[model samples]
Target chain A: MSDAPGVLTHAAVMTGRSLRISRRNLDAMITAMMLPIMLMLIFVYFFGGAIETGTAYDSYVMYVVPGVLLLCAGFGSATTAVAVSEDMKGGIIDRLRSLDVGGAPVLAGHVVASTVRNLVSTTLVFGVALLIGFRPAASLGGWLAVAGVLLAYIVALSWISAAIGLLARTPEAAGGFTFFMSFLPYPSSAFVPVDSMPGWLHGFADHQPITPAIEALRGLLLAQPVGNAPWIALAWAAGILAVAIGLSGVLFRIRTA
Target chain B: MPETMIEAHGLTKSYGKPSDPVRVLDGLGLQVPRGEVFALLGPNGAGKTTTVRILATLTTADSGTARVAGFDVVADRHRVRRAISLTGQFAAVDATQTGEENLRMTARLTGLSRSHAKHRAAELLERFGLTEAARRQVRTYSGGMRRRLDLAAGLVGSPEPGVFFLDEPTTGLDPRSRRELWQVVRDLADGGATVLLTTQYLEEADRLADHIAVLNGGRAVAEGSPETLKARFPGHRLDLVLTGREAYLRLAARAVHHSPGTLTLGLPTDGTAAHARALLDEIDPHRTDVERFSVHSASLDDVFLALTGETAEEAAGETTGETTEPTEEPTHV
Candidate 1:
């Protein structure tokens, strides 16, 4: 037989497979894209007036848009867990492994697809926020930084979800395992300010990774001082990316074994 | 290449708690020559799947060694993998993708160029009678169609004769589908690919395999050609179907074998009409208790029963004490 395919080629082909599956799952795609948008509208129109931000911004959409973007990542990445879990539960994993395909390519495919799905929904959320009178005063550099930070977070979260998918026994259980990730944003700076939350809640809201990520996005978009929030956000993303990638490798071996 | 396309020796694997492990494979050994179809016949939890998995490089045996296509399964796994295709018990095709897509993706993963993969996919789809359903999602296909597609997927990268592992390839298929798959398997071996298949059906092994291994308690109790195995239980037998259950019970002591389900009693004979008549007369002189009687030679079923001390059907209905391989969960289809 001809030389076996390289790892990169396998990853690319698997990525194509994942993307095709994502495209055909219209119900899931629509839910992933629309959930953040619906949440954005509810906060901006329904809950925006009742809540007050300590910032100088006039419209609540400006402060809430970044948090919704992070929410979009959470919801989009959870699908990665279900997709990976489905592959593991089926006979396809054994088929692929028998064909000489390694776990890295198979898991990478899901993470990359998750990132692409999150990006689309993030852009859609941004557009909907703009339509609802949200305006940003950031320069080009700030926009690039925001994109970099969001991409890092989305990719990192997707890997974490992939690891969870490997750990779970079924697709439903994998989806359930990701619930805490989707809810992380809510307890952080996604909605109201940390100070506005109860005293006991401030510890988690201030110290968690989601709060720094949202803080970095809010500061960048509003042209305010971000201090070390962007670096902290990127560090969190990098740390999670490392841990998740390593954990996914271990989990993949364990599950497949 | 070695004449033996697949070989395993003293293979052992166990699962469960460390203190109380359940041995799935205990000193199992197999040798399949080139271009031959070898069948591992056993009931559930007989370690047939485990043996195939070890040889296919999906799972490693806890002890011993296996070589597939002249490469060690554990050390040279990539080489072994490149030289083998495994069609697992479950149909492994992606439900969301079309049949064509599933085949093409497998082709791509196996190192085919994009155009070549497409051409190969279409060729296999046509060959497997799935061309009409090529573009339809696999989720919409019937079980038989899915199995054909799954088999087609495994063949995508195999242009040359190589080791092929089919784990219960026709387990849940209808009779027609099973026969069709048998022909396909025969064609595969006829074309020079060494095939190692596992099955619970004695007839499947008898009909298809050049050599059959009867596995029980994680070891092969008997191994030979169908005819050779049948020769072990040589001689014809008079099979008598009694008129009533009471009559069957009355003559049950005189019979060599009796089946409660059919009220049939089997009495050994010398394959002579006179001997068959004499035995029948001695058992039921008036012929009022006898429904019918027929003289038949021993079959693989009889050989299996003789070797394992249990009818194949009975063995299938219950789990053996030494085997605890977890039953596969039902696929979502």
Candidate 2:
């Protein structure tokens, strides 16, 4: 009999499979990338001038783009919950598990593909933001740092969505659970400054991971003082990733057991 | 003497709380010889799926040990997975992927090289008679095609000298598709693969399996060759064609099946000439109690009902075609 395939080989094969699946479902891809662009347009044209940003709508677009990009990545990552839930419901999961393949590759395929998908949507939104008069004042290193932070945030949130997907009993339930994370940015530093929020909401907005992530992105892209937001954001992303990976492992075992 | 390829000892499984657990398998055991098809025959809630799942290494049993293809299901799970293929009640093929892609992915996952995997996928598509539609997504495939694709996918890991677990593989197919799948299953067994088929139809077990095990209430209530199991019950059955509904109603106490459409009452009996005469004499006191009667030998349907205390009508209803037993001694009344 043939020996079990290596983890990297399994991951590659499964990642190829996931990518093909995503390619086939172009509507989902468009929806993921377009939702953020739509939100950016609405907020910039309708609500940007009223917000107390102390800048013109053109400059406000730049300020809001980071928050919108974070929201885009978070929302895009949540879409993976539907795919993962469907995988759990389908017979293919059991079929693959029955094979002599490493367990990590299955989840790895979804996580990696999800990260890629989020990055694509984030890039599309960034492009759209630029088309609408958004500009950045950061150096090349700052742009790289921004890219690094965005990638880290996407990976961490994708894992969390994957965990929620595995834990949910149905695809609808998974969608419902993961969709709530998109709103997390609204209460944080994504849409408005934490200090400008109402008293009760300010505490949560100031401390949550999304706030630090938004602050880091703002600092990186707008040439603002980042202070310790970059470090805090990295720590939060790492912490969530660890917990999500651990939770997903436990959930897989229980569901399969 | 054939060596055993699959062996399970005292397998037990349960779900829910320890204090108020629901037992699905209780001290169940199975043994199958190499290169033979053994069918686990049972109705719903009979632990057939549970046994298959445990032996396939998809689910673990609470107490027992199961070995498939000479490897322990628990300790050597990887080896067992490598040596076995399971096609569950659901087709399990990716609906969004084309049939060819599905097969190729399975092949690659089974450690076949890229070129080998492609070759294997093409071969399987041709073998399953889906080469024309291999490129189309499986969502467009008919039920039979999907099942064939599923069976093809199961063989990606290889079938020769491998163990196959088919759990109710033909549960919802039409007669034509069901017959075609039965032929495929027979082909698998003839190719030297040890096949463990779980099905609810008695005729499926009788036609496809060399040995049959009747599972009930979390255990094998009876296990033997089809002929041996059939021999355990009464030899013959008395079929009485009634004249009217009233006649069938009167004979309902002694009838195992009362079909209003055919106006026939099936009664269990010994195949002896004397028993036939005695039974007819006892029922003929009313003069018009029965219309016509004939005696025929018992089939596996009778065996399953007798062994598991289940109704034969349920089994007969599930079957697509009639199972005709030979007449040992023709006696009419």
Candidate 3:
């Protein structure tokens, strides 16, 4: 299952540290979880019934489900940005640099931790959405497919967040990047129909990366027609992931250099 | 090459904002023999931290070569990192994690087995006298305790004898903790670990390090045992006082001439007490009641001042003097 005991061992150790940190920061995790939960509740109970859709009101919640899950991917970057920035401010990263540990492994641990956190937060959001009125017409196989897409987005976004964190000089700056990322989906097809957006807004909404990502997610969950949007979404996410990973590597090399 | 634990030949560095380039370490050279605590002393911005960073492979030198534990800092960085550990001046402990948890995390990161990490954390917790605070979050730890935990964290999974780079290990420590940390450093050295450190506290270097290097303007101005450098600088500046004005003028002629009102005769000596005897031979001790015959020889502070051309005392009040390493330095290792 594993090629190198060293890599896995290091990853496991980092995972433990990551999890311990996550556990102690339960309040923070809970606070982050609450944002999506509140959005889910507000959209489903109050706005869900009033909003007009050719689709059923209960079904809109399910339609928005994958988009919200995609939103969780943004948190991976958010968490990393805040944590690494704080560590940098406090001189922890400098100390880590002095240690014998590989810089890549240490950074990888943070990214992995961010992915894990996003997944956990996304799961919580999902559980709450289900309670509010989100039902997928797809089979269990389809549900796993939905999850796989969401995980990819999270991994991709987490690296982006790490890059932001590395580039920022302060924790606030790192955290601030998340606010922009979180807002990206709202203007796209995450919460509302791209067709409902204004003519100019619709053009932007339709073409934005989050738009295709939500469309791909929607198709997977609702047993809707799987089209090229999924391919485009995958390409966008992968491209972003590649850029972030490359930039992170460059930054690490620059620092070590 | 007597197992050169740390060897730097003409190391240099420059840093600033991306737009502006400011040189920090310039053609600096140092060697740390195995199992010795080598101390680097300089004023603020003397490039102590920069030198340590280059040696530790945290930053590359602009030119020259460095090796830690016989591994090149550039080509064999990973190997160099594997053979060394560093405890920076600040505690650098994870505030969210408990003391034991921090150690465990470090152990895990360093490739200890799960059970071994747990065991190592437990052992280090006890050894650092942190078992009592094992469960408490690091934010609640006192400065000394937190630094101890940081050192323990650096030691986790580093069971082999290694080089430990300590940057200003004890700057803010109280007398008791300072003494305790000195003992800890002594133990580390005795146990066959090479330690290279930088400090503004000269007395700490005097007591702890076998070799001391004083950095000035990004260069090693003086490098030797503390005693050797001290012996070279104005080791003995004597004060000769006279009973009468006539006698005072007579002695002050031989000493550095001051005003007639000055009772104290400034005597520059080679720090040898023989100069005191020679000066006393000329002046009749019976004829003149010498109020102050105190001898001011070269101290570590004098060496720091003469070599760096800035007083060490000025390092604390203002950041102006130099960018070497003259500031808060509490690094209890």
Candidate 4:
């Protein structure tokens, strides 16, 4: 009874607490879902006709939805950062730390909550894409694979955002950092093909993590030639997840210390 | 002596960059026996919160050692955390969650079974007089209600040999709310728990604390029972309120100390009925007729002033500056 609770049990309880906050917080919910949907609308209606894809605008929808999904996941994960910073600033973190429950639960809770939140936002973005005449060519198994890839990406990005949130002095600063992070996919294959960029940007766009993730999703959805992109995406996601977990753990120790 | 539930020796802590650091605690030491209400009294920046943080295992000390419930604070932090409950300076209850949710969550994290956690939340909500507000969001709670909920949240698991750490628990509470909280703290002590609270008000310490430790400049300046601290100052004082402005002015000329604003005069006495009577008789009745008079013994307020060289009001004002206020400033105690 004196021991700290089992990590998963404590994390589940912590996650339940965070999810309750998310459910009650209308402002956060609206902000998380609205931004990606709006982006999808503006990108499709405004930029869809003008942008060049090998096929027509209907085919272009297939290309952009994957990118949009990734962007939605990225944006949704940023909210976790804001939530973490707010918790750190509040007396809640101190109270939790002082309790026998321990610190990992706090981190685990945010990561779990944010991952679930990203899942919802990702689903919403995908649904909206479908509404706007987008269709995927993937089989049922491919769609499941798409979900697995997206979950990994969401978990990885959420942990990184948690680190940012813990380190930021204020909620405003955390929001600003994550807002800046949302721009990361722009130079990659998110909105446009990596080859369309200039030489310097193209090199970076191809080599970075988002391009490979987008490439993997696009290959899966369009029934295009499935290549090394899926494996590369998995490697990148796992690596990022490892780094984020380590960095955030260190930051948590320093903060509570 | 009762078994010491908490002990600290030569604890030190600092914040900010190492090149230009701000020392919050310096060679601080303490001992608190089980079932005693011990108060750490200090002004702002005196490290009262820092000391509590160290003992509760929320912050590490730069040097020295601290133990709570016979477990080292540094080496056995989880064990110490298991033995204690902390109600910090800020109301730690989640603003978005209902009062019951906050309490229930705390119980679950502390390892209660789901049914037990729910039961504990219900029991605490009733005990804190928050049963009516249990389902209402905490954001809607009044300050006093929120503070009581925070206190209840800390007690969710009801750890055995309860070691309660309250850092300025009633700083912003109204007089009535403050008294209610004091009764709760007294009851905890009576239930055989070790209670250590920090505060800036001399009256709060006098009312609730079994022993008061005066912390000034991050170190203990004085430590003793409230009665013993008062005894160190000794004797009593005679106070007189004059009839009018003219009388006050006249008295000011003859009296050693007189204030025009209050129109009162103060003189030290040997704290005897005979001395008070003789002093009153010695004063001329016609020149400055006495409106009222009273004799009072020394108080903890005077002891704080003599030992720390700061009035309780000034100490409270300093705290208001350093605190990151969660809401509008609470009316000072």
Candidate 5:
């Protein structure tokens, strides 16, 4: 095994490098920066007038908050997969493979960029929602809890996306995979209430990772009780993280192998 | 005799249909002494790059034993990785980031401290004549500049022992750029780095490599120093540059062989100055005076062509008739 300190330090530095590259690419920044604000505006100005809620219309975005952040994470992660594929297409990955770098750190660089991008996008979306008269009525502790949940989820998904990006045959395949992820945000309760749906749909949604995650975020963002959602969310996040990391390890093996 | 830094014995790779596998390297063996530039020459698809990949620990061999800096490639891969750097056909530097940033990123990955990374990047950029382009995105750089930047990035880590695997590093380059890169390669070798270079250009290998291996059909057709390879050929010829088409054809009819448009006539000779003069006198003075000429002997091209009994391109065709490698199990170098 490699020295633990060395591995962590190298991984952190690689992540920083990826973050800098992501920052310099204006298209990436614009995509992340605009997404949160656009979603907040669309739900608040247009949808707010028409939809009736048992509670305040402004409170609807708080429920939508978890879903929007998931969408944000998916969007950010997909682009990183494309970026890694592009770099690998023409001897770039070959060159990296030749260097004195362990494969893990190289993977770390791309995944970090995805996580950081989603974080920025989530934060921005929440900020915009606040500006548009959306009130959480939640304490700072609650908001922090929601942020922590989002961060954990982001880390898990980013690794899976990075592996996909690295191992895909072509760049177009990488881009096309984004559509699959876009659809994933649908099955989760990111938009409509799960209770409003049919029995089967509600059952499936209730059991899904997105459901517990959204419930927790909704609890924190709207000052409702977290109840069982926090435990469920933690479990879901941990499971997905373990699976994704293992999948990434396998993909990495196939790639270098 | 130089100490050996790399050694591969009876290495081979098989890919394709499980029942009918294609062997890419059939019992290949190689040794590169410490601090020597070794060239692996072959046409496209001759498995030169594949051999380099195996040596760099990027891919595994089916049946063989190999070591880099005395570390087993499969079992002690981290140690192997710590000793080498790779620069592929195109520059590996990130296009979105500035050149300096790319180098610094590599430095950081290789385990330099943050400040040390910055310092190393600056030093390499300057050494590679990229100081002016250091702050610019690599996407905007010219091909030559990008290649230079790529070289700089490879050196950012200052890997111990400096075993570099360069695959066709000078493809599609202008003569001036190619020469400049050659100088860079020479400089690296001079500084005591062990370099493994693969190339299609015969001249580049002859000019740079201390020892050359000519690969054909995934095996070594000829392996020796450039001088030794040339000596093995043991044949010299005189080249007469004719002035007029009619003159060239008339001379060609009497002479051995001639190129169609170039008006150059070849006469097999024993490398004697007198034989060249006799061939010159054989030409009609009115029709053509030698524009300029040289009596040259066998090159790596001639040695490769003669020893392989087939051109490198032919070997590639044969490889295709065999099976492509199957992508099933993970095979680390």
Candidate 6:
């Protein structure tokens, strides 16, 4: 009757809806929270002695914790794609559009919910790493810097997942986007040093976006010289965020139109 | 408060590639005056949903003009959206959310304040007979309850009389649920809201709509009041049951339709005792071949058959084979 709510109000309502959905899907939430911790334990205890990081660290937990944090973001953000895709496949998208809700607010809700979920999982992974003798030399400033860089990456990745959700036709197909995001860190330096890989894979490992993000987080967490890594990581995040946002807008129109 | 709540002219829409496009709406045009219930009756793939989608501003027409609530559907879509509510074929409520939560969310999205949204949600739940189940997840609802909630969601924040588009609102509902929804639609129109509903059931149109448009192949093949459309058939039908296949075969050429399975023959009559008697005497003078005969008034089904030259079910089957839309009723429960 009155004019449809403003974009901010719409986004707030939609964010609440997404969060409630995430809460009710307890199995998914638990899996998202537990997978990173499980992987960190496997890497630190099972494979840490056999592998070398080529860096001086007190324990394997210190070396693997940052990579596991990135993994947590990747896994947690994948649900955004599934959630967005479910909205598209269901009748809710048409209902919302008819209510004068635009694509920006709908996608923004998913991205924000995704960021929140990833941050929670990242904190849990960090807590578990600390319990296992992982020690960080970072000061308060270093911890804030790490949070900023990780937040940027999480926001960017969530937008990308949202775009992928719009692009996919079915929820099952959209879920495939998760595998690609979860696997992205593997080719980079998430698990082991890029330098330790064979010569042919170095070009991708050294140049991909994930490497800089991991290097920035690792350097900041250890209080080592960051050397422009944070700036490069932020630049990559901003670039990806911009493109993903644009692509998602276009895809929403195409899918709904 | 325009006299004509909805209007469209020369609307056309197509799907698939440009070189091999499948036309869904071909220059379809319609007009529904304020507070009137207009029914678009058609089989699946008859472009009923396409027309509703275009008017609701959820999809665009390939080439044509449409106005809803006196605003251009494309140029002033935001205003149009504010003035209309669409209950699509599927129930649009969130499966994970409770019925009350879904209503409150829709209320908030429609610009209601937090407290007002909560109050309106409770009011709608009670109105739609969903108060007992308001706290349960919608995924646990039966098909009928979900539909009621879906309709309630559309009514959120709709304080003023507005245009309503219901695309196959009762396609998969049981008879009781269908009747209940029909009453709701009638009440909506009685309360001064403009209602435009699409359905495959002839009885739904006859019972609820002030005017009916029978659609086939993306065009309105016939449009009029239910009585006017039925009058187009112009007479009653005399049904004859033959005692043997031999008699049925003999009269098959003269009858309008002969069903071999039932050994019955349908003959058009002028609805007079004289004409009925004459036909019976001519077919079987001594009544040796004819078992019995009865004259019945024409129905909308007869009008549809006369206008489209095919039964609704047969036409529905043909369209379902060619189009991507689902022909079978979707099982949402």
lDDT per model, in order? 0.88, 0.84, 0.74, 0.82, 0.74, 0.87
- DockQ of predicted model 2: 0.63
- Model 3 chain B is weakest, by summed lDDT over 10 consecutive residues, at B324-333
**Tens-digit lDDT track of model 2 for A1-257:** 56667989899898888888888888988888888899899988888777776543246787798899998988888878888888888777878888866556888888899898888888889999989998888889899889889999999999999899999999999989987888888998676667787899877888988999998998888888899988899999999999999999899888888
- Comparing 5 with 6 on lDDT, the higher-scoring candidate is 6
- Candidate 1 per-residue lDDT, tens place, A1-257, comes to 55689999999999999999999998998998899999998898899999989657777888899999999999999999999999999889999998889999999998998898888888988888888888998999999999999999999999999999999999999999999999999989888988888999999889999999999999999999999999999999999999999999999999878
Name the runs in model 3 displaced over 4 angstroms.
A1-5, A44-50, A55-63, A87-91, A94-99, B17-20, B233-302, B308-333
Q: What i-RMS does every model get?
A: 1.1, 1.4, 4.8, 1.6, 3.9, 1.3
For candidate 5, lDDT tens digit of each residue in B38-129? 99988776778778778777888888989888888889876777777888876687888899888887777776777987988999998889
TM-scores of the candidates in the order shown: 0.89, 0.88, 0.83, 0.88, 0.83, 0.90
Best by lDDT: 1
Is candidate 4 or 5 superior in DockQ? 4
lDDT of 4 by residue, B98-123 (tens): 99999989998888888888998999
Tens digit per residue, CA lDDT, model 6, A1-257:
45567999999999999999888998988898898889888998999888788757776777888889988888898899999999999889999999988999999999998898888888888888889988899989999999999999999999999999999998889888678888888888888888889999999998888889999999999999989999999999999999999999899989998
Q: How far is A117's C-alpha from truth in model 2 (Å)?
A: 1.2
DockQ for every prediction shown:
0.77, 0.63, 0.39, 0.69, 0.53, 0.73
The best candidate by DockQ is 1
Q: Give one digit per residue, the lDDT tens place, for model 3 in B1-333.
A: 248889999987888776898989889999898988899987678899888888878788889999888889999987776677888876777888888888877766666666877998998888778899999999998777877888787776554567898887777877777787787788788888899989876678778899999887688888899788655454455655566777775676565323345466655576466766776765765745565566644344456655654554463345442222312231211
User: What proportion of true contacts does candidate 2 retain?
Assistant: 0.70
Pitting candidate 1 against candidate 6, the one with the higher lDDT is 1
Global local distance difference test of model 1: 0.88
lDDT (10s digit) by residue, model 5, range A147-182: 778888887777777777766878889878766865
TM-score of 1: 0.89
Candidate 6 local Cα displacement, residue B85, angstroms: 0.7
In candidate 2, chain A reaches a TM of 0.96
The residue pairs found clashing in candidate 1 are none
